[model samples]
Target: MTRTSSAPLRSPVAALLAVLLAASGVLLGAGGAQAAGYRYWSFWEGDGKSWAYATQGPSLVRPDDGTVQGFRFAVSEDSADADRPRHAPDFGAICADTPAKGGAKRVALVIDPGTTEDAPAGEKPPALRTACAQVAPDASSAEALASVAKPLRYDSSAMICAISGYPKSGCGEQVSGDGSKKDGSGKPTDDASASASASSAPAADDGDSGGGPSAGLLLGIGAVLLLGVAAVFQARRRR
Candidate 1:
């Protein structure tokens, strides 16, 4: 008889850990800030058997040595739909390639930045690609992980529009989450005008900086944590 393997589910502690880590800057929850409506992402991680949703975000997650993290972009509406399946595209399919040029333990970030409605001036329409991936060679440390992961969400640069022809209609100014506009010197110029300026920012033509944790890592961490906790519980019970 063949044994069927079900996908692993995230344990509570693992999930909590991921949220805590992500909150510290490993992942960005700024999906609600996109111009094309808030583009939230669904997180997934894979084990050899099956993939599962993370219990928490990337900033809070510390995956076992070689975990794969996967992300798929969704509009705010679709993202809010709790009934949707937690898995998507597949971690194996996303991270199928061998390491580019390293023997170090690594963590991968597979991001789907999502489609844009704007067509660049004097250029052909952009080809539709699935997603982009970033690999951190030495992912053993939290600092290194943050360095590789934070860019996916936060654009430190003041300029929002990278393309030459794309008119700068939104987010030309530096607006914080509170809608307070910051001057060039980085001070809030207007305390009273707190608008949803962050959401109006145009999509960067450069690369994936959408902030979030990989589902794979979170799931893996959760699994490991769960196992560890279960072992402890069993030992205590026996004692």
Candidate 2:
């Protein structure tokens, strides 16, 4: 005779608690911003499982974090390799306060500032491969658990040309095309904007000299007030 063994159970309470903790750390809704116009194409296996990719206009709020749209490849419990937990695919970014359109979930995502071909219609093509693209479903057909873009739907040569003939042809791959690219000021577009302000410090310093020590003294006092408030909050938290 042989004895049978049972696997350990992670308590339902523990699972719920873990979920709550993670949820708390996540920023809440940004409204329906990832699906409105984007198309989702998905691949799946049994057990009603699915995986997806999506592409869309620059997000008005939440943005992509990397090369692909604001999402990642996900593996389910039955599909994962040894020791990996089943996680829902996370490509759609959401905002903490966003509400679902047609009951789909909302999340904060990093926006993918795609190449020149994918850049926003009116803006200068980003010099870098990153920026921001918010997404929201255009219809209710996007309730599935996994999907990826079909390419033809959002590619410049497809939809754009269908409406505007700007791409000058239909969907076709660009020579040497790969998402891993860098053309911006070597920084995310937003960061470069911030750095522009930061780099202006020397000019600001020079401009202030004319105001002499008195202006510097007033600025110093203002800074002290801000620091004082910050210190108070820090001390209270520590206490």
Q: Name the top lDDT candidate.
A: 1
Q: Against the hidden reference, what TM-scores do the models get?
A: 0.32, 0.19
Runs of candidate 2 exceeding 4 Å displacement:
1-93, 99-104, 107-110, 115-123, 126-170, 176-239
Model 1 alpha-carbon miss at residue 213, Å: 33
Model 2 Cα shift for residue 189 (angstroms):
34
Tell me the tens digit of each residue's lDDT in model 2 across 1-239.
Answer: 67433222224334544655444333121111111111111111111123322222221212212212222111111111101112333333222234345533332322222235343235332221111222343311111111222122333211111111222332211111222222332221232222212210011122222212335444554565555555546544543
lDDT of 1 by residue, 83-113 (tens): 1223343445544674444544455444433
- Error in Å for residue 168 of model 2: 8.3
Angstrom error of the Cα, residue 87, model 1: value is 10
| Number of the predicted model whose TM-score against the real structure is largest | 1
Error of 2 at 208 (Å): 63
